[model samples]
Target: MTRILLIGAPIAVAVSVWFGGDGEPQRPKDDPSLRISRTAAAPDPLKAGTPEQQRELEERIDALPPGLADPAKKEIAARLVASAENSTLDWRSQYGVIEDIGDGNGYTAGIIGFCSGTNDMLQLVEHFTERHPGNPLARYLPALREVDGSDSHEGLGAPFEAAWAKAAQDPAFREAQDLMRDRIYFDPAVRLAKMDGLSTLGQFIYYDAMVLHGPGLGPQGFYGIREAAMAAADTAAEGGDEKAFLGAFLDAGRHVISRQKTEQTRDSSRIDTAQRVFLRQGNMDLQTPLEWRVYGETFRIDS
Candidate 1:
């Protein structure tokens, strides 16, 4: 959503197994902190796409109270988001770059699809460079900066493409991917939700929109939507009803989603519709077996 990541991929949702541990559904074996002998869930090699099982996996994590009692357990939210955003639950799947997609960047990259024009992409490149100084992608910093707002492939050539390919193969680069998302979407949304007395669903709604519209006060940006929602109804943060605020917030989100020209696939529409349906059903906690449609493709996770 951040940039035009959904250029032209397969339309049908793949529904793979969702990631866990840190904002993931299950801890990885490679993590040093966990002892290696428990009967935890095995890693599903093929899981992490637009699969029915992804929804089923998310429905199982009812760890938080209504208003996101714990942001640490962000697995379900991120997991469910995979189906809507990337059609893949693995956060790692979203780290590649695409050039010249008319998206203000010849090098838009990362999970939330940070575009070169947006400073977020600068931060992403900077962070990656800092962690892995000698990384192949480091040399292209200047070219990346130069091409920030232009779709022109100008100075970037095989080196740039190879660097991105190399970065994808490194473990440290993968860490940077999650860090960027946290800095841009997850962390801010959770923090704001806590401030606004919003539940996990509200947190998710904010996070999801931020990923799409970028996090500012422009006409269709995340802040603008929230501002519009605030005008329509008072948030619990302002000593008003939480449900009313959430409903208003949702309406605002749908407005933004409707206008995004890059949403060629309309997968984002389901993100809004699903929340609207849940809120309509008074499922403020965003309890599962959720159902909705994106571009006329209906999805029901009632089981």
Candidate 2:
């Protein structure tokens, strides 16, 4: 799957309501058009260090408090991500959000923005079909697979978009999206950040990068960026200052963002005006009453 937005909260419970209008799923007129970056991959394995070093890192992480995983903080993360991804705080309203947005990724849809051009959208539909056979979007599996890795809508067009919208009306489908999102993005990002001995803010930084760059091992993917950052500075688990490591990570993320030619991917405001602002304030715990801008739009999560 390509660059998509996964609202960084446990959504299984939150998505159990109707998100469509009059039996149809429509994007709110006022919601700005969605613009996403690009690809999703399988979760990266713990291969950053030697077995002994990895074991030590695991132990160190096991001793830290639950940071981003905490329910309250997770809500904040969701809104923060929504501000950049959907341009609104009503993340639940995005259960049915779908469009190509002409970023060369086919049919970015659902709360996670699963792209038909990427592998994740196929997996999501497949997973949903497994749970509920003959679902509305099931017939398009072949087309999804055929179009994977590129922005070709070959066999899927209006029929496929309608099918996706129809499927979005199902709470089961919504729950499936949530489940796949956690499995593919959220859970792994948080787990890796914890292993890195990152605090709440650091964990969030990793998650945003993961959503934007995917979990691949490529030079621009989340793991590669982490590797590049670690090369510049040690992780907190490696006995380095948390702030320094996070700064290095943001620098690495900015570099990756800048290299992408797409207008969406090239924008680093998600890091520059959002996450980096928190870092500058030393809000390592990500305390509330937060304010930041992404894509030149300001958002806040006060509690």
Candidate 3:
């Protein structure tokens, strides 16, 4: 019986190996291509410092030198502010400045510049809003869409009317009434009629409205300037003036997009970052962290 059981076990083992065996499948054993080593290891728990130690570290950082702060930092910030405030400039020119200032700066410096610039722009906008309370263009011009039509009187008239109407009721309206009246001389219809010859001052005023209010204001302040430019280009094209319409079209399109892009980019990169960090951390100035770095660098405060 023992012999028979041993013989049966061998047969079972052979069948299992051929089908589903308990043992893992064996493959050709080649020399190991790589080797690894294990070293003695133990967990090193993270060290916890006392509250007093943290306070001491903070105090030491507060003693650093201010010269450690980057000079280009402030310059970048000032330029960002200036660009937003001066959005009346041609888009190409404004974009160039943005591109120059934004290139190759640390995130913190960029944040500083962007926040400063946006703050300046907001201040300027507030001033305009206060000064021209009723002017829709002054208040809401930034929200207009880009101008697109000939005889398009859509964006240009309403802001002026709103401003004038509000000013008329205010006691101080008489003081700057004449200037305001003069500024609003062209109603939307009139402005559309003379779109071709719109003065540079007109363009500036229109752009200023857009910048202060928002870019979406479209052509409310500018009237038919876009259309006339397009018209001139068409005429120039028909007259075989290759340089005329094509140049005008490209130039106008480029200027509009470039300026908007730059302003938006600057706003996003600088203003948005600064505001988030500043508001999140409370109203701390850029100088605080800067001072901390000075102490750490000179006296090894962190060390």
User: In every candidate, how many clashes are there?
Assistant: 20, 8, 22
Pick by TM-score: which candidate is best?
2
TM-scores vs. true structure, each candidate: 0.69, 0.82, 0.17
**Candidate 2: tens digits of C-alpha lDDT, residues 1-303:** 235322222211101011122322122233222111122432235323345544544454445566887889888887887787788888778888788877777788888678887678888988998888889988898888899878888999888888888888999998998888778777777867775667899989988887777776666777767777777776665567889989999998899778776787688898889998999999999998999998999888889
Model 3 lDDT per residue over 128-163, tens place: 468766543354344222221121224434453344
lDDT against the true structure, per candidate, is 0.58, 0.72, 0.26
For this target, which candidate reaches the highest lDDT against the unseen true structure? 2
lDDT ranking of the models: 2, 1, 3
- Return the lDDT, model 3, position 254: 36
Write one digit per residue (lDDT tens) for candidate 1, span 211-264: 766665444666566667767776664456877888888777777666655655
**N/CA/C clash count, model 1:** 20
Candidate 2 regions exceeding 4 Å error are 1-64
The weakest ten consecutive residues by lDDT in model 1 span: 8-17
